[model samples]
Target chain A: MEENKKKSPYKNKAEKDALFEKEFMHLITPLYNFAYRLTFNEDDANDLVQETYLKAYRFFDSYEKGTNAKAWLFRILKNSFINEYRKNVKQPGKVDYQEVESYYNSDDIDEPITQDLRVDSVKDLIGDEVANALNSLDVDFRTIIILCDLEEFTYEEIAKILDIPIGTVRSRLHRARNILKEKLREYARNMGYNG
Target chain B: MIKTITHLIHRLIGKKEHSYCCKNCINDLYLVLDGEAEQKQEEELLKHIEKCEPCFTRYQIEKSVKEVIKYKIQHKQVPPQLIHSIKEKINGII
Candidate 1:
């Protein structure tokens, strides 16, 4: 009986279904958004979210109740995106972020020049332009922004999700926001706005 | 009185101009904005932000940027068809 109990996380199929729906189902929309932002393609986002759910369900027994279901789901989707889906998307090929990380790490002054824009200007910016500015950042920077700002994850949660230290999460996020500000400033310049 | 004035003049001519370091302020300001910094540290930075000019401007810009990102970014919803398909796949596994 003990062996059987260990094998089955839930007493029955009904309990499993109830737990899964109660804990995980409501997160489908936010999960889809995370997937969509990462892929920037609707069809691929659908496929990624589907794959994420299938894997989540398969591994449900391992997940503890009343825990961070959203972070767990996001971790699965992120892993799948890196391991499987990214290959399918056309790209110049894999750019090792290790080099990028190292370069950024080596400098104490890693913050990009993101100043000079008036706070009033930031408020005046439209949604699409802001989105484009965010989307234009490197994927590493972009992913951190989505997780930190968009998802509103804590530094500790983000560290666990990305498998990096809390310090790295803070530093990377700092650089990402600076880069985004720089991107927006350049956009304004292109539009003939006097910065 | 003369000694106090001499110390003041020395401090004024010292390697550091003011006690608040803008470089350190910029770094710590990120922590303060994240709402995760230590309470004591947060209070200190808050006091400093209230005083420093460049740091105050910097804080306002960073805070505004965060606000814009939170509310201004366009959010796309999950497609109804995708939800249906995800449910179908989940059922298939069981």
Candidate 2:
């Protein structure tokens, strides 16, 4: 089976089109999911998906056969999202890490770290809270979380999609996950999850 | 001084999970919990979790948080009319 796939000449236009039609339906859910994660809204996701498909169809000839079709599609969709949607959204102000570190360091050393402190009494960690927390993250952090955590892209794949070094992808993903974990922990505490 | 050196050595070589599991590993834990960790790193993290309780607990917590978020996102369904309109637009473009 693997050998057959290796030798297949689905590289030609007619064969490619037939294969695309046969396989495109399988991509709809994934494409929709990608769009939805990026836009965080249904209408925008739909629009993005439509645009992605249109663009994908136009550039169909450019695609290398028997390669990662999904990643290729996602790359196109992500480019569109950044160019069209993200460009319009005003980015949050940058954090001054030095100041933040100084502020923390200035605090009393004897003050207990709340390694075990309870905050509130809500049981369910609602989605809005999660979304809001994710939204609060910088665009870099947010994109890493969406791609790595939600979409399950590999570090290598994410690097390709975002056009960054693999080291950058790893570091950003780590920082992003840490941020989300901290926020979710706070949210969990607010909702009263003691454990 | 010897005792203090021993203490420092214990702390340095402690059973605690690495403070730097890298962002890729941390984020990958979510997919791991969802039973979707990729081949190579999946084995690596699985071995790490076998001995690292802190990271294991962290994995559980991250998974739970993801579940809550996933539930919320799934609940926010797009309206059928909107979906229809988008489909119409898509067809028109094609």
Quote the lDDT for A5 in model 2.
43
DockQ value of candidate 1: 0.45
Per-prediction backbone clash count: 0, 2
Looking at model 2, residue B60 earns an lDDT score of 55
Deviation (Å) of B83 in candidate 1 = 1.3
Instruction: Report the C-alpha lDDT of model 1 over B1-82, residue by residue, as the tens digit.
Output: 4433544676788732322244677778887777777898888888876756556777888888888888999778878988
Model 1 residue A129 distance off true place after TM-score fit, in angstroms = 0.8
Please list the residue runs of candidate 1 whose C-alpha ends up more than 4 Å from where it truly belongs after superposition. Answer: A1-7, A88-93, A105-107, A110-112, A191-195, B1-20
TM-score of chain A of each: 0.88, 0.70
Best by TM-score: 1
Can you write out model 1's per-residue Cα lDDT over A1-195, one digit (the tens) per residue? 334335886777778777787788899988888888888889989988999988998888788765689999998988999888767757776566777777666764634355466687787788888899998877788889888788888888888888889988988887788778887777667665644
lDDT measured at residue B81 in model 1 versus the true structure, 0 to 100: 88
lDDT of 1 at B29: 82
